[model samples]
Target: MSILNSSALRPSSLILIGIPGLESYHIWFAAPLSIIYIATVLGNVMLLLAITTVLKLQKPMYIFISQLAFSDLVLSTCAVPKMLDIFWYNSREIQLSACITQMFFIHLMLVFESSILTAMSFDRYVAVCNPLRYHSILTHALIAKLSALSLLRAIVVIVPLPLLTLRLSFCSRCIAHSFCTNMAMTKISCADITVNNVYAMFVSLFLGPVDIICIALSYSLIVRLVLRLPHKDARLKTFSTCSSHISVMSALYVPFFFGTLLTLFPNRIPVHVHILVANTYLIVPPLINPLIYGLTVKEVRQSMYLLLQNCKNRIRLWASSRVWR
Candidate 1:
């Protein structure tokens, strides 16, 4: 009898095989992963705080950046802690409901981040190509609406994924990857997964490519406009403004593109390599996004410097008082 056809009790929990073939080194892997996770959280939090509290950063671009920071925070928090649990404690058991929940949020944040990047690209396009109307066009109200719609689109598309997973009877409960994903879950399903596969394909084709195309187009036009500027310094200044966003876009899309390719051509790649790329896809962007923004954007850099100075002064004052006492 086929494993799919055999009548077995529906599993309540699934075992995640974290980094297959690397079980012996899970503890060692946890060390660097823990540091990256902590840095992602702290850096994103600091960026969020700086964007929110600083009066000078209340502009539309900063507002979009804050959204990006928030999304990164949520994305990292959703996956990393569970990954660490598997690494450090060997706690591989995850409930079916919990797995579905994790899958939903993971995809949700991925789509949200993509949409936000597209929106940010548009923000840049307008600012560069139509400087006179940039403020009028990308007002706070419009930025809020764009952010809301990005989130809404993600929720609407991703909500059905977990429900679809629920309809399938799994022949196996062992997830080869560290995290639950649509493909990972569906791979174990006993039933016909045509609908699930179609939806996944639709999301991959529609969301990823559409957003990438929009971003590319936006930058292309921005570049054309910048080149036409009469003053060299003005053109340089305008181009500099886009450098940070371009860096961020590269950081995100390059790994993601390769990771997707590895997933699609799993036969060509080793399992451990696939797992490493998969983890890097989620970890690298969040880890570097804040640092890229802080170092590249002048306003954010200045604000962070000011914040550190204040912290230094407070620490010095406290130490001096303690010595006097």
Candidate 2:
């Protein structure tokens, strides 16, 4: 009887109102999103493999980039599948615990990736602005230390999310979007979310502004140095190298900043718009980041092609061995 009653009490629909009046948009969202999900995963996986196998990409820049690719990979994997599930199957019913879990990882990855980008920006500044001092400043030990710190920062800052979420019992388990996002999930909690709200807002303001400002400042100094170069060709080379990173930074940050602002005023903006924009914040970077580097960096692309050829040859050898066996 108790089991029956508990089962009966569960929310029937995952969506609050089932995707608004945009029924037509479901096809648009589904088809493209599925492609994006596949491409993001495949692209990042290949990049990871290439980084691991190729000796040339073993430097600090590639190490940081591999970390960036990895972070974006996880970020997309966590957020995109749930979205597709929601859109395709109408499986909106996520439990409270699962919601909290998703929120934790999602936020953790976001902060960690942002920190990695900051590190990468600083790396660029050192490599270009102070080329003579670059190697000594960005030693292997220093890179390793920075990597550890980035991981630690992510763990520490994200610890509060799960702990605080555990304290608050949810009233309704129906998340508007596909995934259980920190800001969206918190809004639906019946308990006084004063602590969670304040902490989230604080983290956003502090971490976000500091990262953006620091990155901008790094680029500003780098720009000045690049301009001081006597040869126009040398100046262009410096700018060209940084262009890919700059493009990625802009794409990743702009949507995220806008989405954060929208969350602050959730009531005014229609829920679907909020959800789509928020989803975009998670989606676009993962899809385009690899392409940016692959197209811009000649060596990375060549290495990636070589890695694929090696994979094909290995498969062929395995097949021949299997036939002989």
Candidate 3:
């Protein structure tokens, strides 16, 4: 029996099934996945560029938006390329160390994104609730400190996850999802993963609820403050300023919460549905976040338009010079 058990153990290299039950459609899936990944990268990069070059956008809110864009870029880049590889090239063999590293970055980015969103909410709260003191409260120094703290918090929270995973003995080396996630890897371990499960639950319960409550409270205060504003236009403008943030937050968290629930209750949901939701949870925010900001925020839109016009003018000048030559 011991010999049989030893023979049954998988190799150190793990095979990632891009979408377990949908293997036949992996080729079809890769196209859209690639498109989303490309769009995400381009959109976020454009947002970052706009923020960096545009003087008018050098405010606290845009700074936080740029940070969020950076986080989305990092998060999507960490997962989507590997996912595309699995789907397009059938290159699914990921080493244990590599998988652990991937899991670490993915979770780190997730937490960092959450922290940034929380910070953005606080920024909004200060801007609307105490407009007179907004600049005093959210100074450039404070923004830098908050950004640094967000990264540090993410590192502190996510560093142990891979370590805990490393302690386990993985009997099965096949990950059902496209990416190597902590939960997915934990489920494959032959050891008693009760501790890992508990830790994951602890993190989720602590982080998710705290972020949600803080955001909800911030918005609640904003709403109340807006209601008390005597001018309807003032209230409308304040609420409008918040709508983009709300849309981005919803895009980031809703699918994530739903995906977490699906993971917890995997038996109720179909495997394909779970996988799709998980992918969406990972992919959708980065893809849509820049679009939300670009379309909703006037400064960003104006900056993007200016940048495009410059590019067009440069191209036309080059063509004209070539004709003269």
Candidate 4:
């Protein structure tokens, strides 16, 4: 019987590699992954709150930063907790329904993240290219509109993905990744995955390249405008404002695009290279985004400082009131 046809056997039966057995692998894998998960969740939350609660961070650029952080928050939440379970609890077994839900959220967040980058680039373009019109261009109403458009873009593009995936018949239910990633899941399917694979290709070509191109074009325009300014300090500061973003964008996109290509052309790469590139592509961007923003963006750093002070003051006030009581 084909792996997919034997539905009676657990899907995890097909996917797991060496590690003695299910019980041992769970304990070993779960412990270290837990640390990564905690930091991932905590760091992103702190970044989000720092952006939201600080009055000085209410500008358009920071608003986009907050939106990006929020999307990463949602993305990490969907993937990491389940990953922790598989590692710690010997619970690699997943219901078909849960797998579908996981896939949907994963792609949704992916689409939203790319959309946010595109929007942020546009925000920079307007700020640097047309400074006088920036406030007028990026008003509260416009921010709301952009957010709505971003969400719509994700839903419209990725909604078809799940529907297409549902049509695939599983040949072997085992998924290789720690969690039910799309390519891993598709690999186990018995049915022809041509349509689903084609759709994945469409995402890479249309949504993926389009976002990267848009960001590059926006920055190119910004650079051209910055060069026209007479003040040396202004030109340098403008480039500095965008340098972190450009760096993070490269970090996120370069590996991501290569990983997508590697997945599509598995024959072109060695197994170890494929695995290393794919994992790095997935993990590094999520981890580094908050760090880049925190270090490079003055507003985020100041807000974090103020938030820490506020927390200390609150604790001291509570202690004093308790002593009086």
Candidate 5:
């Protein structure tokens, strides 16, 4: 009976490793991670407020930035706090379903964020290369369609990962990562994971370079047009507009592709190294994206300043009311 039960037993929850080799140093790891998480939340929230509340920021580029902010917020919030939990409190037992849910949302946000960045590049392309038609080309309706398409594609592409995970029975379910990933989940299973690997490759291939390729083509075209322009000031301005998006693109894709490659062929790499690369791929972009857009993009910078100033005025008014009362 014991042998039979052991063969049929499926784990109800899985253990997440904070950092495998450095388990004793998890508290130290939490310090920087917590600080980054706080910054990401504050920065992205401020960006969202700046874009949504400011009338002048309702333009295509800012709108796309807001969408990107939302994705960053979701992605960071879904994974980072849980990681902090594992690091600070040793609270690493995640229910199987919850782990899968986290994995699903993390990948969903990644795909959606990539889609928004690609769309923003196109926004820049139209604005720089075909300045006259920018308004007609990027109507709010078009933005809505693009956003919907991005979301739908993310859902369709990522829904399979968790489902594939769910089908596999796990006797030993200690996952060697802070957050649940499809790769990490599959690694612990004794069952054949060929289907999962192939599907992962399919998802990766379909979702990965496609965004980079689109972004590259859009920028290349924009550069071509900018060079042909007669005015030096106009070229400089064009380059300025493209720079923010490029910074964001680099923030995401560089570490992302490197991490993905490591995840796919994770043989020689140390487990701790794999966890570090994965954590960096998710956390670094969120920390930097808001700062990149806020400082570099003039409209977002000015709008966020005004938004924060307005909040301060309201806070002062409230304080005065309390004092008078």
Candidate 6:
């Protein structure tokens, strides 16, 4: 869309084409996507409550799990409603400023999610590798620092996207994707985008690759230690302890890199495929993360079950206490 006249002024807003090549099916697509969004919200919120309300789940490990749930909640919530608006309501016009804000939060949550996963891996490593001092090392002060640092790192890294975006002038105020990303915005800019391109590469590498490396390193050490255990039962238990996290990490990073690759090879990959990958990357993690943790981790399942039973009993009590007469 950069085919506009060099003198054309930047428009105040951009029009998004919700899922290119599938405009005819936009409304049809809305049903399942809306259901997914609703389910994601409920799942993450349930997991978040389970972690926070359960006394046994107040440990540092579960603290990280809660952060993951919260991150997924914000991540999906940040983008899905707007996307549904575009699809269901045909509300395509997004103010340039608001679009930039959306871009900021979406990426912020993604980066923060990566940091939280890395923190989780570190927690597991410490728990398995240094069992006795797990509590002492992962103190409240340290957990608070790690949590603060996760948000601070996310902000410091992602905040520059909007600042950098301000310097560019758009050739066309039309975005062809479901949401605003650095690449989507840069694609339509009239200005020389070498700096933007370089910075985007830097941000992608910084946010994703660095976090992947840290997670990998942590898990490798944990696995190595687990391998040296004398008893097969202990080894099985340690692997079981790690399976849920590994599943979560795969759910996060695999599609992320796949989407990035699709974005990079835009000509080779179909546009709709790239968009689907991007949208699913944001949505699936929130939906499946709770399932992964809730089902795999016995304590979380028990907590959620208890919470449900308590709610059920309260309803019965409230119904019985009512003055029918």
Give one digit per residue, the lDDT tens place, for model 3 in 1-325: 0111232354567888788788999999999999999999999999999999999899999999999899899989989999999889988888878889989998999999999999999999998889899999999999999999999999999998988988888666678889988888887778888888888888888998899899999999999989998999988998998999999999989998988887778787788898899888789999999999999988899998888888899999999999999
**Pairs that clash in candidate 4:** 3-171, 4-171, 4-172, 171-190
Question: Could you tell me the C-alpha RMSD of candidate 2 in Å?
Answer: 3.7
RMSD of each: 2.8, 3.7, 2.9, 3.6, 2.6, 2.2
- Which residue pairs collide in model 6, if any? none
Query: After TM-score superposition, what is the CA distance of residue 149 in candidate 2 from its true location, in Å?
Result: 0.7
Q: List, residue by residue over 1-325, the lDDT tens digit for candidate 6.
A: 2333455557788888889999889999899999999988888888888989989999998999999999898888888898999999999888999899989999999999889888989999998999899999999899999999999999998888899898889878778899999899998888888988898899887668888889889988988998899999999998898899999999989999988877667798779999899988888889999999989999999998888898899998888889553
lDDT of 4 by residue, 199-284 (tens): 87788788888898899899889888889989999999999978877877887788988877787667776654665565565556
lDDT of 2 by residue, 40-154 (tens): 9988988888888888888888898899899989899887787787677656555566666778888888999889889999999998988899889999899999999999998
For model 2 the TM-score comes to: 0.90
lDDT of 5: 0.88
> How accurate locally, in lDDT, is each candidate?
0.89, 0.80, 0.89, 0.75, 0.88, 0.89
The global Cα lDDT (0 to 1) of model 3 is 0.89
All candidates: TM-score = 0.93, 0.90, 0.94, 0.87, 0.95, 0.94
Q: Which segments of model 1 are wrong by more than 4 Å? A: 1-8, 315-325
Clashes of 2: 1
The numbered model that scores best in TM-score is 5
Worst 10 residues of 5 by lDDT: 1-10
